[model samples]
Structures are given as C-alpha cells and as structure tokens.
Target: MRLYWTMPDELRIHYKNVLQKYNEEFTKGNLSVAWRHLERAHILGQPWPREHNYVHWLMLKFGIHIKDKKEIIGQIPRLLIGGIKVSLRRTAS
Candidate 1:
C-alpha cells in the first residue's frame, strides 16, 4: 500500500485508468482483456484489495456460486488478508 502511494501521482493516475479499463472490460464480459488490466493494476503496485474484483469475475466465469463457500475460497489466493465478501445480488445465485 505504501509502495503504491510512493509512486508519482501521474503514474498512479495512469494505473487508476488501468483499473478503470479493467472495470470496463469486466463489464463487457471479456475475461482475457480484463485479466490484462488486473496485471497492469498489479504492476502499477496497486494493493491486493484491488484483486477482489477479479475473484468475482472468476466466480462468475466458473459458475461458482457464493453459497458454495469452500469453492469460492479455493478460487482465489489466500495470501490476501481479507476473505471473500460476496454480494448476493451481484454474484451467481
């Protein structure tokens, strides 16, 4: 988090745009393009919390409903501090 903030504001802004692009691609249901944005977001030093959105994408792509707690847990990395917090309305039912 500190490292990401240490970056020049201009560069940070560029990464923010990358994050937006990720959102844009995600909304379009283009997983490949969206995944690239996640990589770009990471390279720009965005923190792990940002990766949370990708997990949702994965859950949807794989047809893993949030109610299947264990399955959702297995899909994403556990290294990130916070665990899953699924919004039922947004996730697969």
Candidate 2:
C-alpha cells in the first residue's frame, strides 16, 4: 500500500496522535496495543524499505533490521514466533 506523503493536515494530525498513543502504550508495557499502533503507523506512513528514517525508527522500536529484501522476509516469521512466545509467557505467568 502506497500512501502519498502529501497527506491532508487532518490525516497528519491523526497519524501523530496514533504515534503518540503507540509510544505511550509501549512505555506502559502494552506490547499488543503498541504493536497495533505501530501497524497503523506503518500503514499510514507507507514507508519504503530504503527510507532511512522509517527503517531506523522501526529497527529501534522492534529490535530487528531490514537491510535488504531477504532480511525483510526473514524477519516475518521470527517476529511472529517471538511475539507468540512472549504472549504465551505473559499469559502463562
């Protein structure tokens, strides 16, 4: 999905709000909520893999690097499995 960078002011505002909420959720240890907001941010931003800002920020947030097509694909299953394992451990304890 390609989102034009020339988004409306309202959409930009909404995006910023979502980002703030995402950060808040992360700080509060709400990984699921944070992930939801991050997903929304990714959709709204439509960041290209080569975009430095997006890639850097996402890497900082998720602790994963996507330096190439292969790296991006490799991260999918790892992220899912890690998320599931974390969720299960959270629930079990």
| Tens-place lDDT digits, model 2, residues 38-92 | 7787666542222223423553545442235664565566444544443444445
Q: Please name the candidate that would achieve the greatest TM-score relative to the true structure.
A: 2
What is the lDDT for 36 in model 1? 77
TM-score of each: 0.47, 0.51
Alpha-carbon RMSD of each model: 10.5, 13.3
Q: Pick by lDDT: which candidate is best?
A: 2
Which sections of candidate 1 miss by over 4 Å? 1-5, 46-93
Return the number of clashes found in candidate 1: 0
Q: What would the per-residue lDDT of candidate 1 be over residues 1-93, giving only the tens digit for each residue?
A: 122214467776887798788778878888678877766765554233334455444544433522566745654553243323323222333
* lDDT scores in order: 0.53, 0.55
- Residue 63, model 1: Cα distance from true site in angstroms: 11
